[model samples]
Target chain A: MLAMRELSVGFAGGLALRRATLSVARGERLGVAGESGSGKTMLGLACLGMLPEVAVVTGSVRFDGGELVGAAERDLRRLRGQRIAMVFQEPLSALNPLRRVGELIAEPLRLHRGLSRAAALDRACALLSEVGLPDPASRLRQYPHEMSGGQRQRVTIALALACDPDLLIADEPTTALDVQVAAHILALLRALSESRRMALILISHDLRAIAAVTDRLAVLYGGDIIEEGPTADVLAAPRHPYTQGLIAARPTLSARRDRNAPLPTIPGTVPALAHLPPGCRFAGRCPVELPVCRSTRPAGNPACHRGGP
Target chain B: MLLSVEQVHRSYRMPRRRMFRAPPVIAAVQGLSLTVAQGEVLGIVGESGSGKSTLARLVMGFERPDQGRVLLNGQEAHRLPAAARRQTQMVFQDPSDSLDPRRSIGWSITEPLLAMGLRAAERHARAADLLARVGLAPADMHRYPHEFSGGQRQRIAIARAISPDPALLVADEPVAALDVSVQAQVLNLLLELNLTLGLAMLFISHDLAVVASIADRIAVMHHGRIIETGPTARIVSAPAHPYTQALFAAA
Candidate 1:
């Protein structure tokens, strides 16, 4: 299982993640939904030992029955790709400029499997084909700049799978892609989990987007998981008022927003890490907030997240 | 009568290596003609590489069309000298790349004043004034880009774009970098600015939803051509073109 037990991450700005906890099972896909700075990306980075240098993380981070949160630097490096892998938002920048497409895909193959040059090259071509690239062998010779945004993101996915790791973490992998392409990428991630039984951590701001791909969903607000449950139930009928506001705020069909209706905006901005709100973190903006919510923090109970749309 | 794009066709010839071999050419923009009245908001929607940005750069006078002309208030913009090019400004999608990080927001917004030969103190006062106009604290002038959120940074960018009080502003996917919560704020700001300044705008983006509320007229581009152009209401309700329909379906 992939798990974070009472995990805490703090920075000079303040406590960005406060005693957070969650888990994912084999072949399971968990979607983490939050606002722009709601500690979504921070959680993903913390798991891979890639958190910003200033972040001070405490508590236990474990994968496949081993502790990782406080693992030694050298041990973390070995665990990163061999056991866990991540694909970031911007694939173009993440790719090395000087390396050939083939060399880039062959990296993790060499790093973990220690495959020979010929074998790795052959596997790299296979991965390109699996990701639906045309003329997989030909694309291996091109650099990142020569490919389209969608094609380049596919390459990033190919690299992430090179190690055949137990867990895959994708952080807004399709944000820059066209909708058609984003749908294809999402389908691809689901297929990978089905065929490989790899647990996946998918993070994005779009709830409907994450719902379409995940088995379970976690709603995050101000560095805490405000709600968590089965993806279908939560999206179909959300218990949390903030989640409902997000639904109403979603861009309608045809992308035509109504000026007549007031957009259901989350009232106050997210509290800075250095300045967290008392009671429920969402009390400032929750439309149906109770008076008790502002003075007392709500416990992250699974029952509170019971099945809404 | 704020902006007019007249039959603008921009093309580039492929480099020729042999005398006998003729180089192929690529046409980025076709014979496109449009007009933006004062206080009107025009939207240009298309997939990436569909030349929406090329059209934006052309209107901003950053790229001169190979054929046809661009007129700002009945004055020629393409052939204008660099100083006159300052009359029209642009807000790019990536704020970080658009603004100079080494300098304060105040210096960046006041830059065009220097180019236009304004007195130093006058430029500072005008920039600070524009800052308030954009809903930002004037003291924010001393802050760095990293200190502000994506939406606030875009506000600064808008303040800088309109610092010279240009008749036309071209925002190229200004809110695409922000989340849904913040996209609303920026879109609302643009709408308010249009109503208040009546400034003409050429809003280019891939996200139709973000522009639908603010755009008066919508132009849908596909594969380097504007396939559909009509009022936002008409286009959204009954899109005539297949690409626009596909775009609507995606939204």
Candidate 2:
């Protein structure tokens, strides 16, 4: 359904993503995991053809057998909502406060499906119900602020699903929500994707959330995908030192440690894009850094020399 | 006990629609009571609107309870004199907002010391010492808050909070605004402070895993009430309350 080859995004100071490549088969669920400044969001934007004008993008982004890197704006717009929908991290800001939620959900139907206002609203109510919202009709008349955070997110998902896109790109969908509510939303996304057989790209800094929903996981660091494989396999024995540090740093509920003991952490912070090192960006912080890693950049999938699953 | 809250009930009156109508009352903290001994860390875990922040405010004496009392060192926290009230200090979630942008880092760190009648030279010396203890250079005291990264700003905030040498440190989601790697750095700092300084801490956060990692005892709050309170090991291993079980499951 989607193929990205050697995609790189360059800004004034430095490149955000470098030679990043990925592909997603129809109905496949892929997760992109990385910390801040890892260019996870940039990759998502590239897939949607939503990179800002200032961003100098290279290489190809193919969707449904059509090239998207240099596609016309009109064609991209048609593909954006109708074939490739996206749900963002912040639901409150993504929605319009002045507009009633029902109308907002119906807007996509009107634009993509060209339905009348009444028919679009009816479909909107149905979509809301399909997303497991209670009293869907009354909710349609309520504004975004009137609903709770979880409900607002549900409405956002309803908007994204209104057009029945083939692929759904949910970037940190539950970052701003409460734990239980986030769990419910993740469950909703998983169930909807399974039922609809829609391809999904779940991007987040959280490994547990990704583990819960995605089948394949890609570990991104400093604009490079350090590791990529089956989620369970990669998590069970993370190959790259960077990926290992990330998993170790998370405080898990099941693993009780001494309260006074310090958690294992990556030594240094993520380097700024402009000040990236000569070779592996993670070489500065890797626990088992090789001398060769400083001068030679590892290429291909699972971009690490030390270990493999 | 270093800090004790006894049957505290805090409520706020909602805005009235008409002149004749009485406003509705929303109970932010309802009959909540907990204690923290010297050198102990208490974690209060709750979601948004679950009344955890209200409890923090009540403990810090920022808000007076409608019913019951908040006692620090056996004295009523709300009725304590200014000098006595300084025994407690708090670390907020967002360091960028909590630290004053207009002032230098040194000046901001010494504001509490100034209130304690310390001289400018002594305050600066103490601030320098604190800055070093929190893993920053004394030279950084001259820089502005914006010059530092998110993790460095949090370090500065922690230094400021500990400069007062308060008996209890109320850290409300101190690492929530930080990245994962930076979060470990800050959490390790807090744990080190708790050990070295023997400072009692009220560590409040919504992330169960994070709270479980640092806190000796944990309290699960929901709808303005602490539904469960026990040792962290027991709480994580076998949560008795349904809400706690659900929270663990969700986590």
C-alpha TM-score for every candidate = 0.86, 0.97
True contacts kept of each: 0.30, 0.79
Mind giving the per-residue lDDT tens digits that candidate 1 earns over B113-144?
Answer: 88789997898788789888877888888888
lDDT (10s digit) by residue, model 1, range A102-155: 999898888778998889989999999988888999999999999988899989
Candidate 2 residue runs with Cα over 4 Å from true position: A307-309, B18-20
Best by DockQ: 2
lDDT for each of the candidates?
Answer: 0.81, 0.91
Winner by TM-score? 2
Query: Who wins the lDDT comparison?
Result: 2
In candidate 2, what are the lDDT values of residues B27-55, reduced to their tens digit? 99899989999999999999999999999
Docking class of 1: acceptable
iRMS for model 2?
0.9
